[model samples]
Target: MATLPKPAAISIRTVGPFDLGRLSRLHKSCFEEAWSRSDLAHLLAMPGGFGLIARLYEGGLVAGFDAMRGVGFSLCRVVRDESELLSIGVAPTWRRRGVATSLLQASMERCRAIGAAQMFLEVAVDNHGAQRLYEEHGFERVGVRPDYYHRPNGERVAAYTMRCDLEARCGPSRGP
Candidate 1:
């Protein structure tokens, strides 16, 4: 049997409007088509929008890892009782090190705190790694969107729509 790798040691924190430049740089490093600083600032400024970033530390020094570095980030929006996971990206060298998982977990906690009953996201059909991560986090495939992603080379790809029932996972609330 193959042993699963251990998750990396990191910290997650809420991202604010001031993080636009860092977020943009990280997004560019992770994706072919990246969101600009202006785009990130605008999204984060929205009423229901929020984001989280994962960072690595060692000996009390941040960004200690030469290669792994700062792990990843996640952007989400919650309105009413529903939430959408807009985007998530992990640094290439930091993939499979639990960065995305930590980000997702933190994002879910934030969403639930803000009264989100459910969360949804889309993942490219070919991205099995991301799919597995989402599944591990209780996200289920509810549908598929054909040609949902356009590649830099003009190729189109399909995406799976996944949803997670936060209320079900957390059980019933005992509050007003």
Candidate 2:
């Protein structure tokens, strides 16, 4: 068994257009297929599309070490009353930490703030770790996509579609 990295000071911030390069690098490190910088830029520029990046810091370090790099990110797009979690990635070394959870929570809050009533995401069936995280965050498996993902070696993987009812989890909004 492998040991996970120690938890460090982490800050979650909204990802902007300027984060394309960093986000692209992190995505490539985590996924078999990485999204291009242009794709990330287009999504961030689209209406109701937003993203969040988590920066990991080593405590008691120099200025550069204080903001090492982005360890995780989540991208979401809202259409009408629904929001879809388009992508989420965390570096291998940063896995098992609270980075992904924090990113999801922040994204959910943003979605609710923007009047989204529900959120949905797809996770690979083999990714039990991510599935557990999503389930812990109130997402329930609703369906499955057959052969939805392809591996670098040409193997196909199925994905589970999970959904969370924002209104139900956060309760009814009091309104502005």
Candidate 3:
């Protein structure tokens, strides 16, 4: 018999080179325009690209799995600096439990630690729920990328280029 990787503990851990499966699923769950398993797997293989997941805890089952789901899909040449929130998605059953908040917090902390100056994310222009959440978390709309999202109505939806200063937004929370 082959030994298996231990099931994820119910806590935040670095979404290291491993754990791409859960991360990919979380992306599809959160975004109308989802990424493929292979697409995410390729990103993981590159350097300087970050991803994180939130796993639910039960006796032994991992419920409510989630990921930071960074939006940009890079095939190669991962740079240390750039702004892009590739994606963030939580299992539908896990909605309204602050999972998205926790995921964002974790991702920001990690980004700050790694010396990222700004983070960019494209939210559906009409997605008030997510926009409010992002605003409360310090993200501001810098511009709009028109025809940026694939709408379910088969129309192209606009997306906002929201940017948050990693250090300025996260440092104060640590202390004076």
Candidate 4:
């Protein structure tokens, strides 16, 4: 039904604090509730948090744009040796463009680089698409929080907590 944008030139890589504006746009675009600029800045400054962005280039033209604006991001809260995916959104215009996948991959790599042993996140009960994505990435349902997200009508949406063993996925095995 819809066509996706052409891939960017430069492969995906870790995004640092310099890309705050771009990430802010994407965060606002994707969520009814988004992280405020102060919050995002604070997160970046946090010692255990990992933030990144995707830069696309082609033919001397940054073929792609800040997917962060009105899209999704793979984020995590790294604490001690563990991490948690904070949020992710695919720009409404850029859905199915492999952007989310790229973000996830980069986030995971960041976690590993930061010495995180595991990663986890919470998704709305109705978000099957995200659930599937996480599943494909080796995440499994570890727990659930009933009536988690508050709805406009004062109702609550259940939240499913998913988790994956980062080291297990990319590091040496410690199994029988």
Candidate 5:
């Protein structure tokens, strides 16, 4: 059997309006079309909306920096018993280093704590690596949205809608 790689040391924390700039920059680094700070702040200000930031720590330093560096983020919103993962991404240099996984796990736990029974997210159909990650974390593809993503160059792409049962997959949240 192939052994899974161990994740790097990472710390995830809840973020608010003060983190809009960082979140916006991280989002821009991960996607072709970037979300502005205003957009991120708007999302975070909505009812049931929240965001998480992931910082990598190595020997108390991040990427040779003396301080922890924000490398990834996850945006989510919980409505009633359901939650939606609005966006999740890691810096290009931080990909494959388990940053995304850490953010995802934290997001699920946060949603569970807020009484969410299920969590849903849409991933670009061409992103098989992300699909695998979501599947490994108990998400299953439920449907597809045609032309869900529009590129800056006028190209459109479909996305897979995946869902995970928070109660079954994430269980109860442990106090932070």
Candidate 6:
């Protein structure tokens, strides 16, 4: 049998203000309606808002363009005992490689560590893959929003509202 190459190492870090540009670029690469730097800044500036960035590091190269590349990101916010996942995306080339899973898991852990008892998210009704992922992670569809997403071509799409009990799935909050 041919020997298979090992998977590259992926590291995730909390997004800082200085990383807005990189986050914007990665969002653009992953979504057609990417959030602008100003928009990301606004989101991060909100109270209880937080973001995470995932980087894929290949081999020993650690100081150049190809050494570390942004592959995915998740934006979330906690208000009192509830949290919402604002957005999440993974680069096309890195899809199906566990990047999104890692981001989601990290986001959940972060929210649970704070004081969030549950997490909510919206996904386009047609996005079955994302719905499956959310379901696998203890989320369940609670409701639906009519015409929630507007496309560039002027079409509106519906979305499903999903919720996950953080306290049940991740135990209780550790601390602030």
- Report the C-alpha displacement of residue 135, candidate 2, in angstroms: 0.4
Superposed by TM-score, candidate 6 places the C-alpha of residue 79 at a distance from the truth, in angstroms, of: 0.6
Model 5 lDDT per residue over 1-176, tens place: 65544445788999876788899999999999999999998899899999999986776334466447888999999998899999999988778878888899999989998889999999999999999999989999999999999999999999999999999987774432
What lDDT tens digits, residue by residue, belong to model 3 across residues 56-76? 554434434433322211121
Best by TM-score: 6
lDDT against the true structure, per candidate, is 0.84, 0.87, 0.64, 0.74, 0.89, 0.90
Evaluation by TM-score, superior candidate among 1 and 6: 6
For model 4, residues 34-137, the per-residue Cα lDDT tens digits are 77777888877777776666554444433245432324565677886778888877667667777777788778767866777788899999999999888988
Q: State the weakest 10-residue window (summed lDDT) of model 3.
A: 69-78
Q: After superposition, which runs of candidate 3 have C-alpha atoms over 4 Å from their true positions?
A: 1-10, 16-18, 58-81, 172-176
Q: What TM-score number comes out for model 2?
A: 0.89
For model 5, the superposed segments whose C-alpha errors exceed 4 Å read 1-8, 60-66, 172-176
Name the lDDT value of residue 3 in candidate 6: 47
Off by over 4 Å in 6: 1-6, 60-65
Q: Model 6, range 1-176, lDDT digits (tens) per residue?
A: 65433337778999998899989998999776888999999999999999999998876654567777888899999998899999999977778878888899999999999999999999999999999999999999999999999988898999999999999999979866
User: Residue 127 in candidate 1 has what lDDT?
Assistant: 93
Give the C-alpha miss distance for residue 150 in model 5, angstroms: 0.8
TM-score ranking, best first:
6, 5, 2, 1, 4, 3
Q: Candidate 3's C-alpha lDDT?
A: 0.64
Per-residue alpha-carbon lDDT of model 2 for 1-176, expressed as tens digits?
77666566778999877889999999899888888999889888889898899997875542565466788999999888889999988888788878898899888888887788999999999999889999998999999999999888999999999999999886664333
Model 1 regions more than 4 Å off: 1-8, 60-69, 171-176
Cα lDDT for residue 128, model 1? 96
